[model samples]
Structure formats: structure tokens, C-alpha cells
Target: MTIPPCTESGSSVLDELKAALGSRVSTDGELLQNRAHDRSHHDWAPPLAVVEAASTADVSAALRICHEHHTPVVPRGSGTGLEGGANTTADSICLDVSAMNRVLTVAADDLYATVEAGVMKSALNAALPEHHLQFAAGPGVDATVGGMAATSASGTTAVHYGTMKENVLALTVVLADGSVITTGSTTKKTSAGYDLTHLFVGSEGTLGVITEATLTLHPIPASTKMGVWSCPSLQHAVELVVKALRSSLRLTRVELLDRVTVDALARYTGYTAPVTETLMVEFVGDRTEVESQYARFAGLAAQFEAAEHASTSDPAESSRLWQARHDALPAALALVPGSAPLPTDVCVPISRLPACILATQKDIAASGLVAPIVGHVGDGNFHVAILLPPGDERAREQAEELNARLVERALAAGGTCTGEHGVGLGKVSAMAMEHATALQTMRTIKASLDPRGILNPGKVLAAS
Candidate 1:
């Protein structure tokens, strides 16, 4: 994956790109090299060049130049991503889209928002209070809309509002040949040709480069309530989540945190866990409906051998509880100094989630790994972050073993290796094992759309 000074096209192509982009393009020194890889602990291999795109035009023009030069272009967002989707190799340029963060249009009437792909999710949520409308795609506040769409991200709201695959209405994409195409419609659902919008949603920037997006919005809930229920163990928490999902109550968000994770977070952050495990649930609606929903959920809680149930309607208090959940990654990372996480997202059927959790917990203990677990239990998607210190070869190997066992359990339960996080370089090997048939088809699509394989080469599908 190392480029030999781009001999295929030579210096003229590089000079052409540098001339057109000027200061926007750069060759790797040290800073550019740092931004090339994502949050993964994977080995760093910086791109040959980096481009800080300011607009859709910049992206399209860069793609055109790369297409002609037979060079690869790697699209990047905020680089907050845990997966290795943004990692770069040789003869490629990192298309950094962070500088293009602009909210182009906010149609309150249409209930849709159009923004440059660099727009952050937290900024969108912050700007929505005036209209009482909010964007639903929340995949850790640090993620960008473009990154979320590329990975088909989903989080606490997924059980109700659905994933980015459902939230994104359209995308302005620059194809491999620099031909631009718009997918999906502004008016919601459609019976369109090939559903290309979805095709690229979780394609992880292999099929095309996403420059801008139109996203769906929902009315902010009139009254929102969050609660914490403590359980005996991670298994008990998963059981409670399953029961809560099966109940008549419409839960907005349901998340599970294992004993190991709670203990780690307690040691890292100041917050203490009420028990060995806990479930954070949210109920949203009008004043009367929200209270009624809580009552109904409480009734179901009693049946699940509930150890403790705590509720808070105050926005400040709810935010405090959520702040801890939202900061789970950073807090867990705090426990391990000078180390990166080997985070694995595994989702299973509701009936199988408890089993998967139990198996994962046992596997984690058996593998001699330090894995703290947290997940969106509402839709049976969860993550186990394996902490590996720098130069700890044994820990890395043990973490890898646990990862394999976790995915095996999920797959045996008829689930995927990854639920929200896309198959970037970290999950690429597991994806091959889990999706042998679909993997070839995905490669076929990549080959067909990007004939020269100049768009994000060696990602999602390794070079054939």
C-alpha cells in the first residue's frame, strides 16, 4: 500500500493538484501524519498528501484530479472515529472535511437540515432549540454527520428514531470519476432506483466521497425523563433491557453498562455505580404521556427483579446522568494511561442479547483482557472497549482473542460482527469471516463504481 513517488502519473499530477489547491494540499511531515489515522490503535501509515477541502467544489475537483492521475482519495471527517476508516496509505490524499463545517439551510417547515458534511452532531443539536426541532442521529457527540452516514451510526435514540441509514435524506456525492450524483429525496420515503443513498450510507467512503448531506429532523420532545435501574450483574441488566423492550411501554432510550465497565468508570470518573450493573432508560413525550410511560415502565421493572429504580424529570439532572453515559469512552480511556482502546461493537437479537452478554463477560475474564462494556441495550447493540497500554504486546493479543470470541458469540446468535461501527481496517478481518458472500458483492460494487480503485483504496475491501 506504499506509493513509489506516484511513478504511474509522475510529478506533473502532484504539481497540478498543488497548484489548484495551493495551501489546501500538503505532503506528510508530522502533523499531517498524525491526522491521517483515526482513533484506532492500528499502525499508522500516513497518506502521500492531505487536502483540507473548504467546499463541495474542492472535493469534486480533487477527485477529478486524482481520477485522472490514478491516485486514491481518502475522505475524512472530524477524525474522532474509533474505526480505521480514515487511515491512509500511499499514493493517496486525506480529504479532510473538517474546515467545511457550515449549516447551509435549516428548513423548520420541511423538518430537514442541509449542512456541509463537516458539521458536528453537537452543533446541530445546539442550534435546534429555537425551532424545537432536533436532529436524531447521535453517535457520540464528537462525530460528524458525514462520518455517521458513512458508518450508518446509531446510538441511544436508535430504538425509536432509527439509525443514520434512516435519518439521512440525501447526499451530494463525488463519484470516482469526479461525476457528482444526488441520491434520495427531500420528501422522506421513496421508491427510487437502486436506493443509492442507502448504498453509500454505510459504504465507508469506498463507493464515493460524501461532500454534503440533507438530514431528517424530528420535533423535540415536550417533556423528557431519564432513569437509572440497578441490577445484580451485566446479565441481569440485559435481561431487564429485554423485558423493557418487550413491554407495552415505548422506551426512547435503553442502555446497559456491565459491572466491569461501571467499576472502571467509577475509578476513572467521579460517579459511582449503584450496583454491579445498571440500565439507563429515557421516556419522552408530553407531560402526561411521559409520566404515564414511566409508570408503565416501572411496573415492568418490578417484574424483572429490579434492585433499584431512580427517575429524574429535571433536564439538568437528566443531563448529568447522560453526561456520564456519553463520556463512557473518555472515562474508560482515563483508566489506562497512554493507551488506546480496542473497542468492539456487537449487536444481536433481543432474545440473544442476554446470552451474548453472558458469553462475552466470561470470554473477557477468560482471555485475560481488561474490557469494560457499555451498549445501547434498546436495540441490542453494545460495545466492549479493550484497554491496551502502549507496548503491551500481551494485552493486545489477549484483547484480540476476546474480540474474536465476542464476535463469534454474536455471529452464532445470528448477529453481525459490528452493529453501528462500520468495517474499517479494525473489523475488516472479522467482516471477511462473517460476510464471505456479501463481502465479494461489496467488493464488486467498489470495483464497478471506482473502476481505478482511486477512492479510499485498501479500506472496507482490501485491494484485490
Candidate 2:
């Protein structure tokens, strides 16, 4: 866990960085330890130093110095990533960009906003209410926009609004050599050459550092109705979701919570619903349109033997309802006090969702693990939070085995190893199984962009 010193002449790279960036560079032991890991289960050795970059110039200067010394650089935002995409290695420098937060422009007429990478999603939405627009990409966490773009994050809204890949219009990225380039433009569509914007979207900082981004925005819906329905079984709930997706219903969000998750929510979040498979759905449109869609969705739910139905148009009630859904993880953790959570997600084609989820539930039952299943099922993505008792190696092994089996099942069903969570340190092993030859092409692109192999080394692809 010792950081190898990179020296220049008589002085070390750390000395040079300190001289160049002044107080912006810090070797504080506590800060280095704090910045070494993210919310992921994996932890790495403490970084050599942390560079708090307040502006694009600072990012360029830091990258320039790190590139020169061949020191690995890990770009970080708010450090809320569930994967270790922002985690730093022992010999690396953690480039903290959360200080660059700024909303540069709100083109309400054009339905887009230009923002610095460090701006949080909550802050952006707070500024957009008066404009009657909002950034539709919701990762359910107040994550930095740059981190969201790096992970191609998606959440409950992605079923209708699409993920970050579709919402990000342009990017200002600092290359490994400190050169900055802007990819894409404000134009909605372009038949331009290779789409470099998206190429870097999910690169996870292994290619370059994202300093700023232009994000596509959507008008606030005139009417939004939130509803929850308890179904007889998981199969019934998933069937209802599939039916709703195919029907004329304009669902803005569709989420599923299995019986176990519903029980946890009921106990922890005061969720008043039957302990059965449930669906939390949202409809957005004109009042009349939303009403019609709600009626249609209710009929579909009834066909699947859904019960204890609840609907709300009041903003406060709606927020409370979705808040319960977002608090699923914490509620699940309460199921096993003092247990750590190992969360994993996978996305499959909609048609195969029912079987996939049912199979996972069966696996959880057989594994004797207290894992709760919840998901954005409209697009066929679901998550399992496996709770492990503290320092229980047996439970950890069982959780890992369960995750491996679940991933293999998803891959066999034409799904990905990860849905919104990027292949940070957790899912790197699955990349070969999922992408095969395409992974090699990714390595080629990584080499082309970062020849020194210093950009967020040992992530996305294993360090060669």
C-alpha cells in the first residue's frame, strides 16, 4: 500500500505538484484515506495526494503534471458512486472536481443546460423550476453531473426519459496529456463522424476527465400522478409492468418491489401496503391524459389480481411515495441490523424480466440471504441488496456466489452484467464474459486516448 515516489531532478512529483498548485494539493492522511474509496464494497489503498480542482484550468494543470510524471490520476466528483469508478490507488492522485460546481447556462427555449461537471443534480433541478424544465436523468442520488455521465447512470425515470447516454449532448474533457477537447454540440441531432461524446460518456475516467457537460433537458410535465399497487406475486407484478409498457399508458416511471422489499419498506419507511409484490408507477401528461392512463393502468393491474391500490396527485404525497421507493436500500438494511449491503444490478430484455426476477428470488430463498429485490422494471433492470452480517466471511461468500449466478442468468437472457452501475472494480471480471472481443476494441481506444496507462488505471478494464 506504499505509493511509489515519482521524482523530478532533486524534487519529488509531490513537491512539484505542491509548488504548482499551492494549497490546492494536500497530502493530509485523513483526506487521502477518505478519498481512497467510494460507496462500493471494494476499498483501495490511500491515494498519494488529493488535488481540489476549482476550475477547468486547475483540472488541466493537475492532469498535465500527473501525465508528465506518469502518475495515475483518478477523477472524482461527490464520491457517491456505488461502484468504485472514482476510487484511487496507492500510487495515484485523486483529482477532486466537486469544487467546479456551476450552472453556466439554462437555455430554456432550447431545452438544454450547460453545466460544469461538478454540479449536483439536485442543485440543477432547483435552478430549473422557474424555467419549467428539469434534467430528466435521475440516479436517485445527488451525484455530480460528471460522475453521472462517467457511469452512464439511470434510475426510475430512465424508462421514459432515457439514460445519461441519451441526455448528454456535449462534453468538455481534459485528455491525459492536459489537452482539452469539446465533443458534440448543442444541436439535437448530427450525422457527424464518430460520436466522441458518447464514447467518453461511460469511459469511467479511464480515458479522460470530464470538466463540463451540456445536458438535454425536458419540460416539466403539466400533470404527474403516482400510484402503487400490490400484486399477488412477483410474476403478476412484472406482467402488469410489461402490459403497461405495451399499452397506450404514458408511464414516466415504473418500479417493482418484491414481497421482501415491501416488507422492509413497511417496517422502516411506514409504507402502508400489503406485504406482497408491488409496483410504484408514475404517469405524466395533461390532467385528462394522465387520468386516462391511470385508469388504463389500474385495469391492467386488476387483470393481474393487484390489490390495495393507492394513487396520488398531490405533490407532497407523490414525493412521499417516491421517497419510500428511493429509501429501499436503507429500509432493507434495517431488516438485518448491523449488516452491510452488497448491491448488484442487471438489465435484461423486457420479455425475459419475469423469469429473471423470479429465478433470482428463488436463488435468494435457497441461499438463505436477506436480500431485497427492487428495480426500475419498465426497462427490465432490477437490483438485489444482499445483507451480510459484520465480518461474516461465510455470508460474504454466499453473497458473491449469488451475485455471480444472477449475472450469469442475466447474460444468458441477453442482458448486461450491470445496468446503471459501471464496471468499476466490482464488475470488471464480467466484462470479458459480457463483451468478449468488443472489450479488446475498448482497450485499443483506451490506449489511443491514454498511451501512458495513467488515467484511472486498473478500472473499467483490468490494468494490462
Candidate 3:
């Protein structure tokens, strides 16, 4: 999808966009400033204009204008993505679909739900109970479905249900050329010619703009169980959680929080941190089965000489207990005022989690930086929320030391630098190291899809 070359008339291009989108388009300072960057907290960059798209047609129409103008477009959702995936380049435009929030369709029988790109996770979860169906997993799904699919995000539940790449059934995309394409179906399974469904899953809007999505959903768990396991150290907790995941119990989610992170959550959310480094485990099944699983799981944690085992079957109690797990990101971020959370993720084989986590802690100590570690430990993935002093160059410099070590340690432990977060701007350099020859293949794909390089200029692959 070659956008119109910049060599052409720029005024005509802006007019075309205005004619197509009318009131949906705006050059408002506030909206442009807001859309200029994502949750990345990078220096704000106001785009030339902002297009608050309302429908697929609106997106298509706006893209056509951007194409004609050869203007770069930053695809934005809730602006909740930590990475700078949605930062518009100077002179570019921001395509915000926040108004596209809608639950398009729900196939309860087939266990599927279709939603627009701008629908919030809480909104979808709210509507799921009517049919006893909900989206199973996404990248910490507090953001819109489109953003999650764009990044191919995964969270704790991804250990069991998989990530957006695994669950995204189909997408309605507006390409760089202003063409609309549907790549996959919402069916349970398919063996089609080209699996474009997976292609755009994590393209981060460089390849195309995702306007809508059809997603696979799962049944609401009949019964839910929660438990907190406290261990002497991070290594002990990781060891036991790894073992618990490998065992017979079907754990829906297992999140680990080191002592510092636990304390941060305690201070922010008013939830008491378990006395020791802890792993929060959740299981879902039939009422009786859930009880049996909880009992057996608690026994396993106890075997590790876990300092304590707190289990709850009550829904309200379970929500409160697990809120810390689900809300760890926002809650922990709140602990450090004015400073944005600089989170680095590393994913290694399950067996290496303890060593990787311990090494990370050591690196943090060496750097003399305080980092709160938390993440879905079920898949050997963990996040160290490095709270840097706002606008303090010295703190950021030190944080980079720990960040680089975090990557090195994960690679040394046979894990990836990132489990769910896409390599927007922050991880591109690391990705070059991780993918090696494979990185070239990704670049080729990007070039083939976006030869003119107008979609997103500096993301994933820099312009050649």
C-alpha cells in the first residue's frame, strides 16, 4: 500500500481527507498532542492532525488521504501500550479509533466474540456474562482489542489460552494503499493458503491499520480458585511456580511478584504484600474439581516449605486477592509518582526462571537501582518495573544498565528479552540481536508490504 508520494500536492491530500472524514478529522491541538504518543511516555510529539475514526469506512477514508499525501500514520487505540507503537512522526497524522468502541457480535454457541478496535477490555468483560463467554487472554488486555491484536500481546492467562496471535480469528484492515482486506475467518479452525491472520497480529500497525477484529472467546469459568504462596526468596517462588505449572493442576494464571514489587503493590493498592516473595496462583474448573485442584495445589506449595498458603473460594475474596495480580502494572506504577514505569520483560525456558530472575535481581543491585519485579511466571516471563526518576538523566542512565543486563541474562538463560511486548521502538535494537538472520526476513516482509515506508517510519525496522 504505497501512500501518495510526498512529491505530490500536499494541500490536495489534506482536502481529500477532510472531504472524506468531515467532522471526524481534527487539527485540534489537544487531540494531536494526545495521539502523538502512546503510553510510552516518550517526549510528546503532536502530529499534524488527528483522525478520530468512527468506523471501518472512516479508517479506510482517512488512510486513503494519508496515502495520497504520503503521510505517515500512527495507529492508536486507548494509548495504553507502554511501547511507542503509536507515536506519530512529525508531519504525520494520528488515527485514533477510540470512538469505534463497539461489541460487534457475539457467537456464544461457537464461543466467539467480535469487537471493534476501540472497545475496552472492561467493556467487553462486562458484556460477556450475558452469554457466559469472554475473551480468554490478551496482552494484559486493559487496552482495546485492536491494540492487543496489533501487538500480539499475551498475559498470565496466555500460559494456558495463548496470546492474541493464537486467538485472533480475523481482522478488517485498511492497508497502506487505502484498500480493505479480510485475512482470516472467525471459525474454530482453518488451513488456508496464506495465514495473513497471523501476519498482522503483531505488525504494530506498520503493515496495516486494524479497523476491526473477530476474536475467539472462551467459556466463563464455572468455579474459580485463588491462592498465594510465600517463599523465602524469588528463586524459591519461581522454582515452586514452575513445578506447579508442570504438574497436573490446570492453572489458569500464575503471576510472580518479588519482594520489592509486592511492597509497591501494597503501598499503591492498599493490599498487604505476602510476608515473603510470592506467587499468586489461580485455577478454574467445576466447583468440586476446583476445590480438589486448590487443595492439591496448596499441598504442592507447602512442600516447597512455602511460608504460607492462603486460599479462597469466594468470588469477592478471589477478586480482591487477584486484583493485585491483574492490577499490578497500574498499581505498581502508581507507587512512583511522576516517573513512568520502565518495564523490561525476559522469557526463558521454565527451568531457567529462577536463575534468570535471581540474576536480574543481582543486576539491579549492581546498578544500584530499585526495580519492582512482576510478571506471568507461568511461561518463564517476568517484568521488572524499573521506576526511573522523572526527567532525571542519571536515573535513566542507570536504568539502561539494568535493562541491558536484563536482556543479556534472559538470553544467557535461553529466554527472550520480551514475552509479550512488541519491539516498538525500545526493543528494536534488542530484536536485531535476537532475530539475527531471521530479523532480515522480518524486514523483507515489512518492505514487501510497505515499500514506501509511510505507515510507521521508525518502528521495528528503520527505513532503509
Separately for all candidates shown, the number of backbone clashes (residues 3 or more apart, or on different chains) is: 0, 0, 3
Q: Highest lDDT: give the candidate number.
A: 2
Q: Estimate each model's TM-score.
A: 0.95, 0.97, 0.94
TM-score for predicted model 2 compared with the true structure: 0.97
Candidate 1 C-alpha lDDT tens digits along 312-359: 999998988887787777777777787788988888887788778878
Ordered by lDDT, highest first, the candidates read 2, 1, 3
Model 1 residue 235 lDDT score: 63
Candidate 2 ranges beyond 4 A from true positions: 1-11
Report the Cα lDDT for candidate 2: 0.89
Worst 10 residues of 3 by lDDT: 1-10
Off by over 4 Å in 1: 1-10
Q: List the residue pairs that clash in candidate 1.
A: none
lDDT of 2 by residue, 1-464 (tens): 55545434214768878888999999888888888888888878887889999888888988888888889899999988777888888778899999889999999999999999999999999999999998989599889999999999999999889999999999999999999999999999999898999999998999999999999999998988999888888788888888887885778999998888889988997788889888899999889999899988888888989974688998889998888788899999999999999989999998899999989989999999999999999989999999998899999999999999999999999999999988888888888899997988988999999999989888889865
Per residue, candidate 3 scores C-alpha lDDT tens digits across 141-176 of 478988899988888788879988888888899888
The RMSD of every model to the true structure, in order and in angstroms, is 2.2, 1.7, 3.3
